[model samples]
Target: MASPAPTSAHTGRHLPHPVLVISVVVAYLVALHPGTLPRDAMTTTVVTTGVTALGAVIGMLLARWVSRRHGQPDGQTRRVVLGIGVLVAAGGAGLAVWWQNLIRAAVGAVPVGPDWWAGATLAPVAVVAATVVVPRVTAVIAAAAVALTAGLLTPASAGADEGQPLPRTVSESGTLLRGELSAPEFERPATRLVKTWRGADGLSARAVIVAVPTGSGWVDPAAVTGFVDRFGADVRILALPYADVPSWQAFISDDAAATESSIALVREVAEVLQGRPAGDRPLLVLYGQSLGAVGADAARTWLEDRHPGLLAETVLTAPPAETVAAESDSPRVVVANRTDPVIRWSLSSLWRPATTPDGTVLGGPRVPQVPWLPVISFLQTSVDLLAALDGPTGVGHRYGVEQAHWVTGLPR
Candidate 1:
C-alpha cells in the first residue's frame, strides 16, 4: 500500500519556515540599502529581526526540552502545543508594544514611527516559525541570519573628527580650546575640547566634561553647554572625546584605551591648574554622562590622591550601575533616572546590595514611580533608553535641561 499523504496540520507547520527565511533576507537587504528605507527604519528592522528570531529560538528550545522530559505527544497534541507557542509569542509582541506606548506616554517621547509596526508584524511570524517549522536546523539558520544581519548593518561609531582647528585663546564668547594628546598606549591621537567661558575679569571655575556619545559617536553639545551654564558665565568647560568608532560595540571594546586617555587628559588639566596662582586658579569640577561617566569615575582615585583639593565637585549623569564609587574629598553627585534601563537593569545593581553612601544619589525629574521588579524594570528600562535617543530634553535619559537642578548645590 502507498504511504499516506501528510496531514493539513503538518503542511501548515512547514509553511512558515520558507516565509521566515524570505523575510529575514528581505529585511537584511533593506537594511543594507540606505535609500530603500529611512535610517531609523533600517535600524528598527535590524533590531526587530534579531530580537524576534532570538526570542523564538529560546521559546522553541524550552518547548523541546519540556517535551523530551515529559515524553513526545501525538500529532493532535503537538498541534495544540504549537498553537499555544504561537499565542504566547504573539502575546509577548503585544506586551512589548503596550509597554513601549506606556513609556512614551509617561515621558512624551517621540513616536518610533511606522517601522516599529513593520517589526511588530514580523516578530510573531518569526516566533511561529521557531515552534512549528520541521527540520529544526532551518530555524537555527534563520535565527543566525537575523542576528548576523543586524550586527553587520549597525553603524560602528560617529565616523571622522570635526576637522576644526583648536582654539588658541579664550574669548569673551565661549571658545573651544582643542589639543592632541599622544601616548604609547593609545592607537591614535586623543583629541580634547575645552569650551572656555571667560568674563571681563577672568575664569571663575573650570569644568572637565567627559562626553557621552550616541552609538554613532555623536555627542550632544547642548548637554555639555547646559552643565557648564549652571556654573554661570565664567566657567571653562573641558570636553573629552570618548567614542571615536562607529558602533557601541567598538566603544565598549575600546573602553580600556578610552579610560587611559581620560586619565591622561585629567592629569594634563590638573597640571594646568597647579601652575596657576592659588588665588587666580579657577574652582575645578569634573562632569560626565553615560559612557563618559565610566571614564570620569576611573580617574577619580588618581585625582583625589595626587591633588586632594583640586576637584571641588563631580557630577555624573546616567552613569552605568557597574561604576565603583571612589572615595574623594570632593563632593560626588550621581544623577540617575529610575526609568532609565541602563541604570535599572545594570548587573551591579541587580547582583549587589546598595552600598553607595547616603545623599550621593539624586532622583532625576523623569524617573517613574513604579514598584521595582527586576523583569518588569528590565523591559521598561530597555524601552526607556531607546525612547531617550530621540526624546526631548529632560525626559527619559536625556539630562540637558535638568543639569541645573542636579548641579545647583555642588561647590563651585
Candidate 2:
C-alpha cells in the first residue's frame, strides 16, 4: 500500500525547513559579491549564483518527483518549497548585480570552488525534498555543498599592488615641493595633506619625527610642531588611515588575518620612505600611538630589514603586543601607559600569563614601558581622533604645517 506524505507538526502536510532555507539564502547574500572571484565580475556572479540556484531548484524538484513516486503530494510542502526557492533566486540575482563594482575593487579577482554557492544551498534543499523523495544520494550531495559554502565563500584580499608610489619625499624640503605626500598604503584622494612650509629653513635638522596618530584621525601639523618644540626634534606627520578594512577592534582581536594585512600596509609605507630622496645619513624616527603605534613598530621592523641604515629610531606609545616586535638590532623605543582604556582592554588580554604544571610560564608579554608613554599616548590619540572626526581637508595629518613637508628634523 502507498503511504501518504508526512505532515508538518503545525500545518499537517510536510513543511520544509524554512529556517535552514533562510539561513542558506542569507549566507549566500552576504558572500556573493560579484567581482570577488578571479573571473569577470558579471560573469562570475551570474555563473556562481545561477549554478547554485539551479542546483537548489533541481534538488527541490528531484525531492518532489521522488515524493510523488512514493505517492505523497502535500500542499504545505509545495508552498514552502516555492517560497524559499523564489527567495534564493531573487537574492542571488540582486547580490550578483548590486555589489558588482565594490566587490571587484575591494576583494579583487580570485579562484572559485566547485561548490562555492550551489553546494551550500543544495544540501538543505535536498534534505527538505528528502522528506518526499527519500533519496540517500541527494542528501549526501547537499551535505557536501554546505561544507563547500563554509570553505569557499569568505572574502579574502587578492595580493596585487605591493610597490611604492611615485614622487617619494625623503625630507621636509621634498614635502614642501609637493605640499604633502600620502603614506604608501593609506591612499585616499580626498584626505590628502598640503605642505605649506616649503623652502622654510631652520627646521629641526637633527631628527625627523614622523608622528602617526593611533586612531583614525587626521594628523595635525601644529600639534606635531608643538611636540617637536617640546622634544627639540623636527616633526613630520603622516595621518594614517583606519587600521584595516575591518574595524580596529577586529584587527586587535586577530580576526581574519587582520595583522597580516596590517603588516603589508606598513611594509608598503616603509617602501615609500625608502624610495624617498633622504641622504644616506638622514635620521628616520617613527612615533605612533595605539594602532599607529602598532603600525609604527611594523614600519620600523620592515625598514631595519629592507634598508638597514634608513630607520634611525622607532617610538611606540601604547601599542598592541602583536604590533611590538622583539628588541631588534635597530634602535626601537616603547612608551606605554598602565591605564589606557585600549591598553587595558586589548593589550592586557594579549599579555595575560599562561603557566605550565611545573610553574614554567613561557612567553611572557614584552611591551617594554617608556617614561613618556602616558603623556605621549594620550596627546597623540586625542589630537588624531579630533582630526579624524573633523577634517582639515587641505593639510595632511600634521596640525599647522603645510602637508608638503615630508621629512623634518631637529633644528640645525
* lDDT, candidate 1, 167-230, per-residue tens: 2332222523333333233223332233232222224544444343332234445555665566
- Pairs clashing within candidate 1: 156-246, 156-247, 157-245, 157-246, 157-247, 158-216, 341-381
* lDDT of every model, 2 decimals: 0.49, 0.40
Query: Candidate 1, 36: how far from true, in Å?
Result: 30
* TM-score for each of the candidates: 0.64, 0.34
- Specify the highest-TM-score model's number: 1
Candidate 2 Cα misplacement greater than 4 A, ranges: 1-206, 218-226, 230-233, 243-281, 344-351, 354-412
Cα deviation of 357 in candidate 2 (Å)?
25
lDDT of 2 by residue, 186-298 (tens): 43311232122212321324444555543333233343554555445544443334332322543445332323323444444455556557763235566655555556666
How many backbone clashes does every candidate have? 7, 45
State the RMSD for candidate 2: 16.9
Q: In candidate 1, which residue ranges exceed 4 Å CA deviation?
A: 1-71, 74-97, 109-123, 134-173, 181-219, 240-243, 275-277, 326-328, 344-388, 408-412
